[model samples]
Target: MNDEGAVTGRRGTRITSGSGRGLRGAGEAAKNAWRRGTGNRMVRRTGLVATMIVVAVGGIFAGLLVAGDTQADVGPFAARFSLTPSVSGDTDVQIPPLGSLGLDSHDGPAHLTVRLDTLDQDRTFALASDANGLAAASQTAAADLRHGVILLVERSIVAGLLGSLLLSALVFRNWRRVLASLGIAAVTLTATGAAAAITFKPSSIEEPTYNGLLANAPAVIGDARRIADQFSEYRDQLQRMVNNISKVYSTFSSLPVYEASPDTIRVLHVSDLHLNPAAWAVISAVVKQYDIDVVVDTGDINDWGSQLESSFADSIGSLDVPYVYVRGNHDSAVTAAAVAAEPNAVVLDNQSVTVAGLRIAGIGDPRFTPDKEADRKGGSVPEQLNASGSQLAATIAAAGTPVDIALVHDPASAGPLNGTVPLVLAGHRHAREVSFMPPVLERPETRLMVGGSTGGAGLRGLEGEEPTPLEMSVLYLDRTPALQAYDEITVGGSGTAEVTIRRHLAAGDAPGEPASPAPSAPDVESASPDPGTQASPLTSRPGVTTSSPRGN
Candidate 1:
């Protein structure tokens, strides 16, 4: 039978052969596409599983890293998420993880040279080819792990998004085409991911650290007192060392004069006067010997200033002049508050007071101490003391008050701004002594001085049983005292030395406001440095001699 364009071999059937071949070709093409799609879907699904594992692991690790980086009181500015390196090769040195270890400040003023050695290519290639390609995979894993943030932002983002789309498309495939679409999509994604894994590199960056610090509070008060005592000693020896006139020794400035005056004033001081009974005795004798005017006892007057029966407080009360004060690290803030509440002590913190014709302001260093009862393990990280300085400067600016003397307890806070103060008095670094950093010595707008301790030296009972308080100085300024002969006194000493105040006033001598009397040379009870003579700052006072950093 034949019909139109078709010819057939059977009697009852008429077929069109021209269109049959075309239909067959079209069916074959559609089947090919179906197979391809199924293969890609499977590949895409596998890649998605691998990516899910990668992301899950990365997230878990990232969380742990972030948690560990935060301090109880501070933050890791750069290490919001750090990569701590684990050792694999050499035992010679500790290789800090890249971008994790921050630039340290101990090297001085946040400056240093850095040297680095990264992986070599031959080794990298070997790592890429070994162990059934597992080593290559391992290397890629390590790189991705180390550069987790980078991978997360780059390849990971693409891989995740693409895999999700592919998986979605495969799931929606027609009734009989599910497996085919999943298989094809999966193959495409796997190939893309492997390529992305093989070649990823991180960019290097250098971060810089700067200096800043706040003034000492407890110390300035102590220095105020010390200067008074030393002035007395200087008065006693004035006649012997002078090449000049009649009143060779006459200590003038009194703590009261400084406290009562209203003018721009300058002060220099130190603190943590863990004065022992013996030391107090010497200090008392020194006070009476010089007839000092003004003095400030920056806390820790006794080893335990808070002990109900404290000789330090009694000694302080016995002293003749007006003295300012604040608590020490060892002293309880509550006790200090109580003391300040009374009329006996000033206990200045975040307070401003006029002194020696100058407006001197103070803020006690609130050292971040760990509460043992709470078993608080972490504390604030070491930040450049300047951060506090900036805050203080802001306070000063807001109050619109100018200061001449600054006091701090520890040397660690004497960052560059610390130098900006006319005189910064501190006591903790019994070693750094009196360093003179000029306002443009090595830098501009900066000058510093490390006042040695007043409680003499040796390990005191605080940590171990021995004695190390401080041995310090007194300052003198003439003219602000109410009377020409107003005198103040401090008494205490180590039996070996007794402080004696000897004054010979000239007719016109106005001993009223002066701390050190006019033109008198001085003598010292102990010419030899304290036992930690090796650690004494006076021995290393900037102009006195030269010493290596480690030497002191």
Candidate 2:
């Protein structure tokens, strides 16, 4: 009986072991099946999500293209504004027959465009005829543009939401996915709009890249530095300028078009504007009137070279020609950077650039004198300037290319550059002076021409007994890149309204020869119109050459 019981126990143990093995095998199989099913479900969900995202993004872009544009009357002009998906953000203003103005307005993946559709001739005529109409119309136009922009935004949002829903419904045939797509569209657009708004630069308007006939428009519209009291006068001046432009355009169309010599390059040299808004008007006027190929500014463009003062350099982009600039004692790196940012500007600091068929080299001043409390480094001012000038001369020598002009802010710095370049321009003395250095050794002769204050010494002019005159020079260069002649333009400051132009011939003396002494008094051709018939800034009398020295 005991043997039989032991055997029974052994059998029971074996049976239990067998059942445990079966249960373990079944559990492993079930786990494997569950993992496969879970993976499949996850993959399906991921695919659906991706499809919904793609559809939403595509629909939003389509909607924006179809419904994001709006047309409205901006004063006397009918204009259309549009928003579209883009890789980068920009604002484009398009005017028919004229060219377009482009601005880097933001850093989002969207672009905005403003197009002038048509003009209301009757409204234009009526507003132009009134003395105060331009100011009033400008205010109305700003309001209308704001309203139109708001409307466009609202419509774009609604359209994008609707478009996402439609696409989601068609693709997934599910209400949940459609709602999800709408949410995603909303989030995307909100984020994009926020980025654009945060990065938008209203000041960019002052630095637009002008193209077409509109390239010359800034001269007519003026800059944005006028005082509130001058608004009326500014408006009046704008009106008169517009009328003058129209007459000129009509005259151009009626008469034979006057074309400048193809082989001749005209350069307008201006310096020491000191942030004077009037200087921009004068520069633009001279550029347009003289058909200038390039503009060379010697320095002192700003008083302090502060970031706030940098915006004044925006006008350099509107000059419709290449603007080559160097730094002065008053200008800092901040000012140089601002000048370099303009689309048409070429900033030279111990560097060289070829512009408008002329190779030019320049160097910035070694001293920063604006901050009186700042520590002085390197050496004394004159010594540092001399070193900088020597460095530039070395750089030009290494280039193995002939530089047509060399620019410096201080005459002291210019001494080391003698015989290095044919023409060296400087502008620190605040007086127009010219001298020719005879060739030494194998070096060629060099002409040093100094320009006066283009802004009439800026606000400092008020402190002087006599107002400083606004001065600039126009240089004519032949295809050989040699100086042919130059005109000295002097405008009376402190409300003098008098303009004088003195022309000088560079062909009077042979190369390497000493320049003759300047006449006791150079002949000046003055233009002073009556108050009732004030000549436009664009108008100037023809320049008459003086019998002064060859290098005058």
Candidate 3:
């Protein structure tokens, strides 16, 4: 019995030892699996943070690079200028290929022609410059343009980055999600940039590309400071070119404002002067030739509405006829002040004025920056203009002053008053258009006449591929104070001096007789001709019978 008990105790001890060994092996396996899982999680987290950092940094850099490149690609103004350091003391400035501004590397301003959409021919401004002057002016203009382009590029890049960040904040709820998304975006952008670089590798690497007329030109190593100094001096000189243009226009004048008869009254309509001093000459000539008793100017007389531009008002004051004015989207209180100071000027903002037995009411645009809103795009009528139209209509209705003519700068603003008045005159479109109000709108005979740019887009017109034309209208009224007939004049450059004159009968049903045509040989009609072409003789008299449509 004692031997059997010892054997059973030994067996029990062996069983207990084997169970303890098995438990130890299972515990080691569990610890190894946990370590592997934890290690993978840590690796993934580290990689994600690194990716986010790279994406954020690379995206910003790529954005800036693209902005700079785009800015550098577009040259400012119509002309491209190149300045090179010559062995001689004078710098060699070349204006490659001629442009609308009539900029030539060899020919000076004496031979420069200004092609406008307003004139019948390419008009010449007595710029009166030599080789030295041209070189100096080109240098200055190039510098100013370069500075402007740099500021534009920097602003664009900053705006883009800020917009992206704002958009991300709005889209992402959590900080981690934002970071992750930004990392992904950065990776995508980097890949795109790499592909672009491979496709269009730059050929030149000697110098950095710059914006403006001085593009692709080599840097002047030794005389960089001198070149910079020249820019400052030439900037003033370049401004003189504008002044010179103004002076040339100032020299032209008409005979005098007069009426053909007591039963008939003639008026000159102009708009969108935009600070082109040359407009004075056109105005003077038109007034004299048409025997205009009054002149109606629909706003935008000045471009920036600054006090400095007020001097152009001197031309308006010089017009012998009654100058009736209204404010436009481009005009400001400063412009109003300037126009008010004119001896013959009458500024009518939400007010009425009498000229030649006709009551004229006017309204100013509501928004100073008409181009800021989305409605201003695609040549669609601006919302502010619609609002202004409502305001004008309300003003006219409240006064109940029998406004014969409603004057506003924007045609959109004039819509509300279209059927309420015999004539609604506006100017913002820079193109002449006549639209007759439908009978359903209340008055079937009411007409809206939109004038082209009278200032011919002023200095602003010369900046782009196409310049606005010089345009104005001559209206004839009989004893009834109703529009009898009108002439639409468009003057501009098209390989020669070109003038397009369209005449139309009154759309209104007021009592009146067809007035006689514009006086024979109006001096202003044939003022500026092309270099070699003969000035067109003003032979046809306006107010003649025509079957032309009343509106476009």
Maximum-lDDT candidate:
2
Candidate 3 lDDT over residue span 286-372, tens digit each = 676556889999889876555546778888767788899998776778779988998998998788877878898998876554224
Task: Write one digit per residue (lDDT tens) for candidate 1, span 256-366.
Answer: 222313231212243555543444444444345334444555444433323332424555566555556655544555446545643435666756576546455455545
Q: Residue 138 in model 2: shift from native, Å? A: 29
User: Per-model C-alpha lDDT, please?
Assistant: 0.39, 0.75, 0.57
Steric clash count of candidate 1: 81
Question: Candidate 1, residue 503: CA error in Å?
Answer: 17
Candidate 1 off by > 4 Å: 1-270, 302-311, 341-344, 368-381, 384-387, 416-420, 438-447, 457-470, 478-552
Candidate 1 C-alpha error for residue 209, in Å: 42
* Sequence-dependent TM-score of model 2: 0.51
Which pairs clash in model 2? none
Error of 2 at 62 (Å): 56
**How do the predictions measure up, each by TM-score?**
0.36, 0.51, 0.49
lDDT of 2 by residue, 278-344 (tens): 7787678779887899999999998766665788998999987999999998788999999999999
* Model 3 misplaced stretches (Cα beyond 4 Å): 1-134, 140-262, 370-383, 441-444, 463-466, 507-540, 543-552
Kindly give the number of clashing pairs for every candidate: 81, 0, 14
Which ranges of candidate 2 are over 4 A from the true structure?
1-260, 373-375, 493-495, 509-542, 545-552
